[model samples]
Target: MLKDKMKEVMQYNSILNQPNAQGRYKNYKCFHCKQMGHIAKFYPMDYKKEVSDMKKDTKVQGFKASKSTELITYPKIIHFSTTCMIKDTDLTNWDKIWYISDQINRHVCYKLDNFYNIKEGFSVTKLKNQKKFLFTYELGEVLIEESGKSIMILGMYYAPEVTLNILSLDLLEKQGFETKYDGNRCTLSLIFKDKEVHTFDEDRMKKMHNKYLQDYFESLSK
Candidate 1:
């Protein structure tokens, strides 16, 4: 039933592609911002390191900080990303990008590199904080408590047939999401007025979800 409804919605979205389409889409509001033509939490990017970053040794430009030796559990790479999508809005602007990028570098990836031996050259590249970076970890006994909150950061099992990256889970959880997993399958959905911080994921989402769980947990431990 839901798939059929989705099909109808897609058809309506296609109409916007017409030569002279305009105005708010009927029954086609974005789930993310509750606007038109998008969803509330749409994240489609490679959460792992990009190949271009590792392709060559470009001069160390951008933000620089002292390298440190620390014991940190880094976000496990399950897959890489190529592209992402966002609704057309003024809210999605350069300022947010720069801010997010800075956070990712200073708080998430760079710190993790200090503790764990992440991919080569990851330590040197300037990390950018995208919404996606915060959530990506392997599921283990590790739990990171941040903002005075206790939560587990988990990761995906590396398999022979699949690649993974981070996406919407972090944002969803921030909005109070409830997720569950059986070590292999992760099912995620919004929890309305709920208090439990336990998040869930399955299939491909599980790998990324676990990574997030790991990252969050490690951050708290530090």
Candidate 2:
């Protein structure tokens, strides 16, 4: 039985700061300007803006444009399936990105594998410490596209130690959304579904996620 239901509903918790470098990954935060050391999808300024070119198209909605997100795993029993590569991007392959966070205050988005369909319990995350291993992940919903508009993340969290993919501006301000900021760009306007939203600037953060170190995004773009 799915390995006895994965040993009675999974449970993994043990991460007392394991980043290893760059000042322990600058304590990871950057859900954009909410800053700490940097990670706002690889923050870096002087980005002249230009991603509206998706020319060689590739295959986004079905994923393959690349940066990470091939989903569908099963690390424990469930017949031991495979294929999991988070470190995702849904702002469209401008360059791969999906990291916006208010420190994931209990999920409004969080993905690693399973893609989207998880449910019936599972979610336990942390990067600097906050040990929480309830069901250990399996709640879902993820369909962000931005620019072409589609935002529909209703509660994802299949976090397998999340490599990249976190969008929780304080749990999207508790579901009613309405966040605004201009300089470094950040916009999430109210009640979507028709109103739509997306304004991450820096030319959509230069097409998303670069993975720090361009002189640390040019010393925070000065």
Candidate 3:
């Protein structure tokens, strides 16, 4: 009886170790190329070709002059009065903390001073009047604690040229948050998550924008 029981256990272990009819131990799909049998981490990426293709596509689109005189609707801004602390260090001198709904920006951007020990080697080119400049920067992440709640800002670019940090509308939407603009005020709420967050009224929003504009013009003069 003991010999028969041992033989059955060995047979079960052998069957469990054997591959399925398709003959694959495990199936893996590449997230980037979307091909099977391999993962994204080990896949050889062609960065140069990707960047070249992107530039070519942009050039193909070209530029078209707008002929319409109709006024375009701009997104309302939300202002925060709380201080932005980076890793237990209070940024007392840095006061401008506001978010404007911008559909064009793909990533969240912050001033270089807001982060600590950023990892470098990334650059972006911005074109103005056919002139392009290399905007080099490092990437950093920060925890924004506001109104008794905290949100982690991932993949934030440390841009030195920008006067104020901007939270991208695309990023917010991608994170399952929705924004509703009612001309004078904007509300940001999460779709599936229930949490209390900070918001600004119309009057305070206007004040924040005015203060930023004043500081911007003053900086230009100097």
Cα lDDT tens digits, model 1, 95-212, are: 1110111111112321221122222231133225332233422221212222234333233111211132222345435645554543433434446746758665566798888899
Each model's Cα RMSD: 21.4, 26.4, 19.8
Q: How are the candidates ranked when ordered by TM-score, highest leading?
A: 3, 2, 1
Please give the distance, in angstroms, between residue 199's alpha carbon in candidate 3 and its true position after superposition.
29
The TM-score between candidate 2 and the true structure equals 0.22
Q: Order candidates by lDDT, high to low.
A: 3, 2, 1
TM-score, one value per model: 0.18, 0.22, 0.38
User: Which of 2 and 3 is the better model by lDDT?
Assistant: 3
lDDT of all predictions: 0.35, 0.47, 0.51
Model 2 per-residue lDDT tens digits across residues 1-222? 997565323311111222432475567775533545445344433111212234234323332223665664533211111122123234445323455655456443333332534454644443335343323455566765544554667776655444455566767778877656544445555656475566657865664556445657799879
Which candidate tops lDDT? 3
- lDDT score of residue 76 within candidate 1: 32
